[model samples]
Target: MSRYEEAKLNYEKMGVDVEGALTLCAATPISIHCWQGDDVRGFDQKDGRAGDGIQTTGDYPGRAGSFEELKADFLKAASLIPGKKRINLHASYAVFPEGEWADRDKTAYRYFIPWVEFAREHGFGIDFNPTCFSHPMVKNGLTLSSPDEAVRRFWIDHCIACRQVAQRMGEALGDKVLNNIWVPDGMKDVPADRMGPRLRLKAALDEIFAENCPNVIDSVESKVFGIGLESYTVGSGEFFMAYASQHPGVYHLLDNGHYHPTELVSDKIPTLLCYFDVLPLHVTRPVRWDSDHVVLFDDELREMMTEIVRCGGLQKVLIGLDFFDASINRVAAWVVGTRNAQKALLWALLQPHEALKALQDSADFTEKMVRMEEAKTLPFGDIWREYCRREGVSADESWFEDVKAYEREVLSRRGT
Candidate 1:
């Protein structure tokens, strides 16, 4: 018998459906972030100023300087990745027509029509984020929560505009757009009044969501702290969790890199899924802090995906990638992170969840332990190779050769 056939039979004996797992993995769509191409430097303006709370280290060559280059890099990266995919864009990536531009608050759908066209041509759904940092309006590292009414109003208007923009994209693409909002509002040192900023933030969000757009799935992301704002963050997990609970449609986005080192998003996913109908995730690698490292097929990633699979949340959860590492080949970074994400999902799907759960319920602790350990040693790589082959992507490390060739031909031409 063929090797794959033998492996398939082995998995079936363990109550795992290899074909079903491959089918589910192929159908799952992962949202790829655009910032990774340009190092979070968007097309809205040429301010050349670094982001307030967000930062990308290293000045690796071939960072996309314009929209055309970013698009090319993103497409190259997408080509190497397997499974269904979508593009996640930030408001800062908005490109104007006829070299005309509007400030964030007055930004319109015309600026992002090209994105919709590209998505339509490539069969990709779009996700969006309102840029809340690296702007003049973010005075004192506070926006939507700033005591200054004018500053608060500007960000509020900008977020509203972004929502409308996302709503238009969703309507155009015929898929709901996940519009996420992340603010860098926090204090570097002990603040005299923590409640005030959070209260102001709450009020601003209420105003922003006053006019609801069904096509736009609004998600709020909270951070433990940022570079300068290390002491306290206004939008802590508790704050946004409560906000999402109080609101009907709004959802809380858990960025694995956004939490403290001790906190695990793997644990949080099941808890949130229990209470909410839909949960959005930004799968990323965090080293020491929210450094936005490329994801790997590591323990945390496997655990997080396993939880989603165990909870039967493949349909309920929206998965997206959030990371930018300028130190390596940009396209390769995207390929590795995204492919690893798919690997984790596929691995999770391959688990015999029903049998494992039954073993636990029946108090077959020793047998359950043995089964879990044995399943790990199964020919998972063989299954992965077949899936990648079917998906028309490189099933092994051979894909890296393509990335290197692209860099030599295309990326190298973009001189310093």
Candidate 2:
């Protein structure tokens, strides 16, 4: 019998429908971030400053210097990834007419039409984020929650414009676009009045969401702190969680790297599922703090994906990758991270959740432990190979050979 056939029989004994799992895994779409191609250095930066708050390490050669290069790299990365896919974009990635420009607040749907065309060609649903950091308006490590009304207004208007553009993209694509807002508004030192900044942020959020677009799914992201804002973060997780709970339409976005090191976003998934109808997740790995490392198919990722499967969150939760590792080949970074995410999802889908949950209910902890550990050792690689074969992507490390060839042919030709 074939290796896949043998593995299928083994999973059948555990009450898993192998074909059903494969079907589900293929259907689920994972959004890959675009910033990884260019180290989070979006095209809108005319001043040439890399900006603060968000950072990407390593000056890897052949960094995408323009929209065309970024697009080429993005497509190259996308080709190697399997399953249903989506492209996540930032407001800063807007493509404008040559020799023309628009400020953040003035950016309109026209600026992003090229992106719409590209996404449509690739059959990718578009997700968006407002670039609140890396801008001149980020006064005092703040934007939406800035003490200066002008700074706050600029960011609020920018977010409003971003939402409208995302709404238009969704309309053009015939699918709901995930429009997320993340502001690096925080303080480096302890503030005398912590309530002031959050209060301002609350007001700003209210203003930004007051004008809603039906096609857009609004998600608010919070961070514990930023590089400069280590002492106090204006939009803490508790703040946004509370905000999301109070509001009906808005949902809190959870980034795995944004929380205290001890906390796990995996455990929080079910909790959010209990509250929000649609939960948006930014899946990233963090070595220490919000490092935004490329995701690995490691323990935490598997646990997170398992919880997502067990809680029936596959449909409700929106999965998107968010990391920029300039230390490695950019396209390879995208392929590795995206493939790992798909692998984790497939891993979760292969589990016999019903049997395992029954064990927990019956308090058969020993058998549950044995079954769980045994499931880990199954010929998972065989199933993965089969999935990759069907999906038209390389099933093994041979995929990197393509990345290396592209690096020599395309990435190597670019100037430093």
Candidate 3:
């Protein structure tokens, strides 16, 4: 018998539908972030440097410098990845007409029409984020919660405008656009009056979320701390969780990288599934700190996906990639991280969740442990190869060789 046939029989013995896992894996939509290609340097800036806490290292030779180059590079990256992929955009990536520009507050649907058209062409969904960092409007490392009314007002207006743009993008594509808001509003030193800033932020959120856009899914993201703003994070996880619990429509987003080092987002996923009808996730690998590093098919990632599947969050969770590492080939970075995420998800889907749960519920711990360990010996690599073959992408390291050829042919000549 063929290897895949043998693997399928083994999984079927465990009550796992191998074909169903492959179908769901391919049909699942994962949002791919755009900032990775150019190292988070959006086209909106003159120097194209994302100076705010969104930092990236390495002097990669072929960083995309313009909107056209970025689009081309993104297309190249997308081609290397399989399954239903979507583009996640920060408002800072808004494209204006040649010789004309609009500040964040004044950004309109016109500024993002190209992106909408691009989505239509690729048959991909689009998600949005109000880029709250890398701007001059920030006052003393704060935006929505800034003490300066002008600074707060500017950011609030910008977020409102982004929602409008997000609504329009969703309308254009006939799919809801995820409008997630992540503000780098914190302090380098502990603020004396914490209540004041969070209160102001709550009020600002009230204002930004006042006029509901039917097609926009609003989300709020909290960070433990950033590079310069380490002492205190204004929008703490507790604050956003409480706010989300209070507000019916606003969802609290959880970035795997945006938490304390010891905390496991895998554990939190099931905890959140118990309450929230819908969950949004930002998948990134954090080494020690919340540093946005390329994702791999590692233990934590597998555990995270396992929780999502076990908790029946496949339909409810919105998955999006948020890592950027200019230290390697940027397009290759996209391929590796995104494929790893899909691989992890597929791995989770291949497990026999029902049988395992039954074993746990009946106090059959010994059998559950034996079954779990035995699964490790199954023909999983064959199944994974079969998945890649069906998806029309290379299953082996041959994919990287394709990336290398593209780099030598296209990326190497850029900015020359």
Candidate 4:
């Protein structure tokens, strides 16, 4: 038998439904980072210029040139993925020097306009990260945790401006633009004297939500670290549940990599779903040291998928492959990482509900493990190939190649 056939046999041994797997696969929205390459700038440790001594407040990478060029580059990178056009704008563009946070009005408007136009012209949506680490306001972190009143004001104003811009852009494009807000506003030290800033930040968010910007959905991102501040108020899951619940339009956005090392991945999704409400997901693998590494699939990932299926909220889950500058080509990095994520989702869907029901109803941990072990494993690429072969969809060697070809065709017609 052929290698494809052999792989199929292995998948079948897992006892998963092939058709159900593909259906979940196709429903899954393949997303990537908007700032697709070395263009991402912020947090001097990662991609910023060396020896600046300044930790934050670096220049924006994508804004090095004209706005038109940046817009075109974004389109070029996005065109590579088939049936997957949604993107998450890097926080750097909205906060770095020459970015939206730098200007109160014009620059912010100019910065988001191109993306809005791009979305309108291409029929795609854009996700925004409310400035996390660039501006002086965030030097110590933002929202419910900033010590300085002036710095807290700065952060709050930036968020207000983003809501306004998102509203305008939505009117311009006729679609919702997601406002993703994650704060490095947690404390590593003692938790005293943190309540004042926390209350202030909460009040600020309440004011922003009262504005009722129809174009924006505030998705609050949670993290475990406090940057310059001695401590943070909103780091853990319980904190997010309490804080986000008070707000009208905001929802908790769970980053897969942000959980504690000892935390159970399966328990997280269902627990969050049961309590704080399910929002969009920021998908990425976390290392033992809590570094955000974009790597391949592992056996542990199955737990996350199992929980996702168990919750029966697949539609609420939005896929984001949150990778940093570890790869040579950003597009290739996203496609490969996303492919693995999709495979995991597909495998989870193939699992019979009966198996999950058993686990959910069981009191014994060993019984649950046995049920989990009985679920089948599906080779993602092989399944894709099989589906394509059955449906007569031609297989491309690489997603990047497909992207380049499309770019050439589009630019050629534009006479670039």
Candidate 5:
């Protein structure tokens, strides 16, 4: 018998439906971040620099130099990946006509109409984030919770404008646009008055989320800390979780890299599933600190996906990728990270969850351990290859050749 046929038979014997896993995984959409190609250097800035708390390491050559270049690179990377996909865009990536410009607060939907056109043509959903960092107005490392009313108002207006832009994008694309808000408002050292900033932040969020937009899914993201902002983060997990819990139609987003080093998002998924009807995730790899590393088919990723599938919230949760690594080939990074995420999900889906649950519930720990150990050695590679073949993407490392060719033919020509 053929290898795939043998693998399929083996999986069936274990009560795992191989075909079902492939079908479900193919329909799962992962939101790919746009900032990866340019190392978080958005098109809005001519200086090509991020904010105080924001930093992109390494000087990788052939970074996308323009909106057109970024789109082209994204398309190439997307082509190599399998299953359903969506584009996650930051407001800083907004494009404008020649000789025209708009600051963060003054940004209009017109600047992002090209993104909508792109999404429509490509048959991809779009998600958005308000660019809260990399701006001059974020004085003293505070925004949305700034003591300066002018600074706070600027960011508030910016977020409000971003929501409108997202609303228009969703209307244009015929899908709800997840508009996530993550502000870099924190202090370099311990702060004397945390309550004042948090109170102000709560008020700012109240104002930003005051109006309801039909096409936008609002999400608030919290960070434990950032590069320069180490001691205190104004938007802590407790604050946003409480706020999102109280507010209707707003969701609290969890970034895998946005928490303390020891905490795992895999464990938190089940907790959030209990309270939230719908959850949004920012899947990323955190090395030591919250360093945005390229994701791999690692243990944490597998555990995270396993939890999502086990909870039967596969469709209820929104999955979006968030990371930028300039140390390697940008297109290759995109393909590897996204494909690894899909692989993790597919692996989780292929598990015999019902049998495992039964074993655990009946206190058959020995049998459960044996079954789990055997599952690790199953013909998952064959199933994964079959999946890639069915999806019409390269089933192996051959796809890297295409990325290399593109680098030589297109990326290498960009001036030094």
Candidate 6:
């Protein structure tokens, strides 16, 4: 038997449905940020809030619809793509201050409460991502790294408010809300001045989870690079892991595109999974060092997916399409991104472990890498065409037409 067949048999012996496995692996929610307005401007100004102006005048591209519009668009998009539930709220932009530090904090809570209530009424889970840039306190950054006490206090208050709202939302949704936190408090020029703020944030997180809700997972997401003076603080996965270890309720959130292109996630992923025991994953395609790419799969992605399956780590994964393409239609972008994700999952499921083993066990890792790269590049549409041909079934454009037709039907039913 081929390696795929062997793995299939092994999987079958475990009483796992290979086909069902693909669907389940593909199951992930479409998370949307609320502040993305109608225009394709990168700055979110839906709430009519202040300090929302952009410093640079470059034309920013991506979906820039309001909260309700984005939600409706996502519903239409999700209906077309099967097996996805829940949408992430853009809590970051929602909390941006209009002016004055005190007023902004109060205004933030006012804006946040309604979103929590909306998520509850809609039967969707809310994933809260804290935005530290809204307040002038963090024009540089926030958390323990802030040079000013006023800025640090402002961040703490905002975090506290976020946790409170998250707790209430979780309670309303039967603890379905995911309280996610990704700090932009790292330094670029300086080596380290934010250690104190980081420590404070950790303590605050511990208190939040200890108080109201144990159901919500506090996912600490990390980026690969920092932008300014406070840029280098938490720029890598290792920093996140270390920081998370200091707190009781915190867990690491891994974004695929945040690492170096050549980094072997197969080994790295298992270590993180085992370390945390229970963790949430963020999925996306990163080009060079820049993330938010809405493109299809690449070679490194195949290695990441294969290892996740080999380690039996699908259940812990929370798939996210972190792409932002303003040029494309908002609704269509979601559709295409979700479809790409679905295709990636299918490809991962069909991957043969024995093929990987043969390549790895070979003398030179270079040949193995080349073969793995080829496997990753396999197109789902082409695979479907080949399957039809092999089965002696006539192939036509009608198949694709039917798929699009079904999508439109779902969207119509949703009144999108």
TM-scores across all candidates?
A: 0.99, 0.99, 0.98, 0.75, 0.99, 0.70
lDDT score, candidate 3: 0.90
Report the lDDT tens digits of candidate 5 across residue range 299-386: 9999999999999988888999998988899999999999999999999998988999999999999999999889888999999999
- Residue-pair clashes per prediction, in order, are 0, 0, 0, 6, 0, 20
Worst 10-residue lDDT window for candidate 1 reads 45-54
lDDT of 4 by residue, 1-416 (tens): 86567766765565656666666666566556654343344332223431111122223222323345445555555543334456677444543334224433222655666566666677776776655454434543454356677666666776777777777766777767777766667555676675665576567677656788888877777665433443444545666667777765688887766666777656667766775444677776777633456546676566677678758767665656666533344444555565566556666766666654666677666866775665443455676666545533333555567645644554334421
1 against 3, candidate with superior lDDT: 1
Model 6, residue 15: what's the lDDT? 38
Worst 10 residues of 4 by lDDT: 50-59
Q: For candidate 1, give the lDDT of residue 20.
A: 92
- Model 5: how far is 102 from its true place, Å? 0.5
Model 2 off-target regions past 4 Å? none
Q: Write the per-residue lDDT of candidate 6 for residues 319-340, one digit (tens) a residue.
A: 5545555444445555556555
Error of 6 at 222 (Å): 1.8
Candidate 1, residues 113-216: lDDT per residue as tens digits?
99999999999989999999888888998999999999999999999999999989989988899999999999999999999999999999999999979899
Local distance difference test, each candidate: 0.92, 0.92, 0.90, 0.58, 0.92, 0.54
| lDDT per residue as tens, model 3, 284-380 | 9999888889999998999999999889888889999999888889989999999999999999999988999999999999999999998867788
Model 6: residues with Cα > 4 Å off, grouped in runs: 1-18, 26-65, 93-104, 107-123, 192-212, 229-231, 234-236, 264-266, 353-416
Displacement of residue 41 (Cα, Å) in model 3 is 0.8
Looking at model 1, residue 415 earns an lDDT score of 67
